[model samples]
Target: MKAAIATSYGSPDVIHLAEVPMPTPKPTEILVRIHASAVNAADWRLRSANPWFVRLVFGPFKPRRPILGVVFAGEVVGTGVAATKYKKGDKLFGWTSLMKLGGHAEYVALPETGAFAPIPAAMSYTDAAAIPFGFGTAFSFLRKAQVAQGQRVLIYGASGAVGSAAVQLAKTMGAQVTGVCSTRNTELVRSLGADHVLDYTKDDILAKRDLYDVVFETVGKLPFKESLALVKQSGTIITGSEMPTQMLARLFAGKADKQVKVIGGTALSTAADMKHLAQLSAEQAILPVIDQVLPLERIVEAHARAESGRKVGNVVVEMG
Candidate 1:
């Protein structure tokens, strides 16, 4: 099996393609022949081991997992005796947990009970593989915010992977969605169901007088404090990165009035959430906005593109 492995954390050049042993499934796992995978910001973040603090998990000097990919869309080629939910040739899409990152290979073995879900008839492998990180993150945050119909929701970086998904999900939940992006993506965000589009590059989102019931900062730019004024009383702010000190202060201050809440972290995805997303796709209620698709051999280049943090949506890596 050929895989792109990282022996140490640095530039995308550190990742190189090489022949590696194919993985086998354990009694509770399944061996998937990967067809496609998507690169999340987490992939590059882990590769470079940025922020210094994350080195505790990735490594102080190098990555713990040599092959770095989390989301995958593949077919079950073999399954362990204990795996009953799927059999040979079952097409699925999902992600492994934090400790089991090996989706960059031609094949990977993961627990059958992980976030895996059957790919919808309407979804292609490329699109299915793109779901876990972006869609899963959006679902988790919206669920946390308890989004409801008619609520005013603001989404920063509405053209990025998670931001794009958040716009669609917020619309599905009947929120009046305001998406912040660049002028180039205003139409794209509108097509994704954002009720309003603001170009953060030209306009001042903080200057907007309308307050939001929920503020979702998907790009990790604009500190929590800067967005505080936009949140309505008793409203909440959700970010896709770790909660910093300023966010903590708002979290505590809001407790007395419960007017504001700051939340952040990777989402805990479930098969049920993936299934729901599949249904939405089949119904054409939600469309996966893929920015580009690259062959697995070009993974290093894909990492570079993802690192720019300017992509309009998910960038997929086709494996098979």
Candidate 2:
């Protein structure tokens, strides 16, 4: 099996293509032949050991896992005797759990009960590879906040993977969506069903007198205080990306107001969530926006592209 190995945390140069042993499924697991994977913030963040806490959790000096990828789109090549959920030739796509990240390879073995669902026949592997992280995260958070129809919702960093998903999902829930992004992505966000698009470079979001029922900070770049000011009384604010300090601030801020709720934590996905996303994709209700596609051999370039901050949506790597 060929994989992109990251021996130590550092620049994208640290990742290299290498031949690794193929994974075999356990009695309760299934072996998948990966056709495509995606490069997301999780990959680069773990690779660089950013935020410093990644070092303590992953490893002090090096990464615990060498092949860093959380989502994959592939076909089941083999299944253990006890794994009755899927069989050979079944096409599935989903997350590999952060603890067992190994999607950036030719093959992977995971438990049959892991988060996975059948990919629609019309969808391509590259598209399926882009869904789990962005759409899954957005789906979890929006449902957590209970975004309902007729509510006003604002999404910051509306052009990125999670942000793009958030915009569309909010609209699907019938919320009046407002997306904030760079001047270049105004049209893109608008096309995703955002009722209003704010160009961060020129729009004065704070100047608006109207407050929203929900303010979602998808990129962690938006200031907590600013989000606090934007939400209406007793509204919810979903922070998709929050550092340790920001988390503490969120706690204090929530307590201080007593009415405004601040939600921040890891986004979890289940088999049911994957199934819903698959159905939405098949119906063209929530499309995964892709920026570019690269081969597995150019994993380094893929990492660079994902970290470049210029990609509009996802950076997919084909296992060819």
Q: How far is candidate 1 from the true structure (C-alpha RMSD, Å)?
A: 1.9
Please give the CA lDDT of all the candidate structures: 0.86, 0.92
Q: Which parts of model 2 are misplaced by more than 4 Å?
A: 251-255
lDDT digits (tens) for residues 197-253 of candidate 1: 999889988886438999898987866666677788778888776435645665545
After superposition, which runs of candidate 1 have C-alpha atoms over 4 Å from their true positions?
Answer: 243-258
Residue clash pairs of candidate 1: 234-259
- Among residues 3 or more apart in sequence or in different chains, the pairs in candidate 2 whose N, CA or C atoms overlap within 3 Å are none
Q: Give per-residue lDDT, candidate 2, residue 144.
A: 93
- TM-scores of the candidates in the order shown: 0.95, 0.97
Q: Clashes in each model (backbone N, CA, C under 3 Å)? A: 1, 0
- Cα lDDT tens digits, model 2, 1-320, are 89999999999999999999999899999999999999999999999998898999899999999999999999999999899999899999999988789999999999999998999889999999999999999999999999998999999999998999999999889999999999999999999999999998998999742389999999988878888888888898899999888887766664356377777789989989999999998999999899999999999999999998778889999998
TM-score of candidate 2 relative to the true fold: 0.97
